[model samples]
Target: MKRLPLEGIRVADLTMVWAGPFATKILAEMGAEVIKVESPQAWDLVRTLIPMPGVEEFWNCSYYFNDYNRDKKSVTLHLADPRGRELFLRLVERSDVVIENYRADVLDKLGLGYEVLRERKRDIILVSMAGFGKTGPEREYVGYGPIIEQMAGLASLTGYGDDGVPYKTGISYGDPVAGAAAAGAVALALIRRQRTGEGAFIDLAQREVMATLIGEAFVRASLRGEVPPHRGNRDERYAPQGVYRCFGEDRWVAISVRSDEEWRRLAQAIGRPDLASLTLPERKARHDELDRAIEAWTEQIRPQVAAQVLQAVGVPAAPVIDTEAIHDDPNLVAREFWVTLPHPRMKPWRQPRSPWRLAEANPTPRRHAPLFGEHNTEILGGLLGLSQEEIAELEAAGIVGRAPVDARPGG
Candidate 1:
């Protein structure tokens, strides 16, 4: 086995919810020691968002929380308390990176902003992933992924053409995109620090990162007076491109005709060779008719079969794998895209392995997410050199603990 890229690095992860946790998840996957710190009074909401019916340790049993937070240690602390603040500063002194996704002003208000962390560790890198950046006029506005999509112009570009209404994605799309960028930003900051010997403050706005995904839309708006009208699943450049229904209930296959050659192959595969000679303009104008014809053929076969048949004939086609089916997908299974990790509170279930394929390092999930504050003793007493007696005092003061002090199960 080879050494991971971040073997010796330690991250003080003050991130909660998806975006920050997702970023730290990647960092941990790359072999960084990520210490996930949450306040006892304000623990991660995902822990209780979908609790098991009668599980006593509901906070520690959430699959949603465990999936994203695996391979990291948890430590409870109340930053508002003077003792907790001093303890966090001590942790920072020994950490290489500090990351958070609080609202823009929250860190500053807590008086543990970038400069304070830099003071503790001169080469500390602080990555702040606010909904909006720290210095912007909209910095105070609080938002999650859906709001980010709407504000970033993605929702406007995503609807059925006839409705003229915007649509949000089914998932929290903004969170993962921003998280991936934040992880990359950490590496970039680390690289810069190697040459400059200085700390960096990374202000990553979720909305800005989401907007970058549609840069071509902005170019069209500026260069050609084009406000992209929603085309649903249809692409502007491709003529015969849409998701067609297959035999099973709600089963569908997405097919795209990038060139006339692909269109000919698709038409031949569907037993409509007469339609193969149609030009791109003709195909675009008669897209509805073509879709009906395609669906007529597809509705008799399974989505996977339809996709495989089309793909065998040199057509770009794939089944629209639903949430449940995606896990069992043959392609994904072949690539080993999922792994099952042992959880103390929950049964071992398959979770997504990191998409990052570092052929050399080949990162793997090492451990389940820590029980809330499971590492309080190891981190404070072992790493910080605090005596066991001193740790007991902090735990007694509600500055550190195993479970959240104000935990409200299923709230």
Candidate 2:
């Protein structure tokens, strides 16, 4: 097997929920030893976010959680406890990085601020991903993914053309977007530490990262004094760009005609000779009519055929692959973008492999996520050199555990 990029690194993952987990998941896939530290009193909300009716231990069985949390170890620690904090500081001393998506003040409140951890280990990289960052007027406001979307100004941008009200994407878009940025920040911070041998603090704001995606809109606002109106999937620069319905349950194909040549070819392919010479402005003005015409041809045709036909005619087109369809996508399957791993608590299902195809380093999934506090003894007893008796006392004091006390089988 080709060695992964981050084989020698160890990260103390203090993030719960999506953004933090998503980043750590990527790092784990890249061969980092990520220790996911969560509190016993308040576990990762995602572990119990949704309950499956007849299944026992749904938290451990959640495909949603397992899919994103593979290749990592879990260690339950009540950091608010003095003993737990001290033990965690020891782990920090041995770790290359500490990452948390806690609210800005959470660590400071727990008396485990950056300075405290850095005191224990001089060169420790810390990545804090608060929604509005550590310092800002809006920093105090509590938020989750939906709230972040609204506060970031992205929700204002998405809407059906007929409605003035904003709409969020079907998924929590902000979380994963923030996650990718946070992961990249980790790589940059690690490289910087290589040169300087000094620890750095990274404060990433979810809202700020989300706003960066709308740079063109900001440019328009600054120069032209205009906000973008919803174009209903139509590109402002293109005459005809829309998703057309294909034959099947909600199957669709997104198509874009970039150039006059492409439009000509598309027109020929659709057998519309009379409209072939229509100018860009003319086509754009009648985009709705064109969409209906395009759908008329596509509504009975399968998505694969629709996409292939458009692409063959030089028009860019792709079928919208949803979660279920994505696994069976021939291109993705051929590329080996999905992997299956068996788990004691869950049935085998397809999990997405890392999209980072570093040709030389070729990172692959190593194992399923660790059971709760699965490595407590390995980390505290072996690595930290704590005696077995001390480990037992900590467990007795409720400082460390294999699982949360309140972990009644979710649903």
Candidate 3:
């Protein structure tokens, strides 16, 4: 097999929750060695975010935690402890990168700031994913993905016109966006370091990354001094574009008629032959009537069938696959987009493969997320050259553990 791009790269992952872990996940998929460090006193909260009923070691069994954390190793180290801090710095001296998504003041409070890491390893790449960045006026403010979206002005643009209430996406939209950006930043920093022989500190604000996605909104506001009106699923440019209900309960298909020809095709596909010649302005004026006509035809068929009929007639259409049904999506199945990996704690289930498919390198997930601190002995003894007695001492002192000291029923 060909070598992956990050085959020799090593990443010290100190990120918890979604944003930082998502970024390191990409690196791991591309063949980087990602060592996820969590404190025994306060391990990643996601481990117990949703505790499984009647399950021992529920932390290791969390599907939410395992899904985002596959292809990585776990090490327990309480940074607040002086011995643990020293051990982490020792690890840093041999690592190529250290990434974290703490609040702006947290790293410095623990005395493991960029400057400290730089002293340990001169060429260590530090990627700090603070929610608002380190230098801004709101740097000290704490936030998560939902708050990031509202603060970034994304939520302001996502509401139905009638209700006048902004709606956040069903998922945490800002996290994965920032994660992808952070991964790219890591690649760019690696390139620059190769040329300059210097490390980099990437101060990525999640809100800033989220805000960049709405550039067109900014441009329109700056030029015309107008806030874009909430249009729900309707697009001003594409008349008669909306999600319509299909036959099954809560099943829907989204249809967009971009060009006049496409609109004509869509009209005929829904058995409205007389409306095929309607102009753009006419369609815009009668969008409600067209939607009713479209839904009448759509409600008679399954979402997939409705989508297939419209798409076959040259109209842009797609069925909205829900969480459960998405697992059986034909296109994804054909592309082998999901892999089922064995886990020590959980049963094998289909998990998403890396979306970044390099035809030559063929990067694949190597293992499930490590059992809590599963690699402690391997890393401390093999990689860091610690003696068995020394590791045992650390464990006896509650400095390292296989389970969280603060573990409870739910996180």
Candidate 1 off by > 4 Å = none
TM-score ranking from best candidate downward: 3, 1, 2
Pick out the ten consecutive residues of candidate 1 with the lowest summed lDDT. 402-411
lDDT of 2 by residue, 353-397 (tens): 888888888777778876677788888888889899988988888
Q: Model 2 — TM-score against the truth?
A: 0.95
lDDT of 3 at 58: 87
Give the Å shift of residue 149 in candidate 2: 2.1
TM, every model? 0.97, 0.95, 0.98
lDDT of each: 0.91, 0.85, 0.92
- CA error at residue 380 for candidate 2, angstroms: 1.7
| The candidate that achieves the highest TM-score relative to the unseen native structure | 3
Overall local distance difference test of candidate 1: 0.91
**Candidate 2, which ten residues in sequence have the lowest lDDT sum?**
402-411
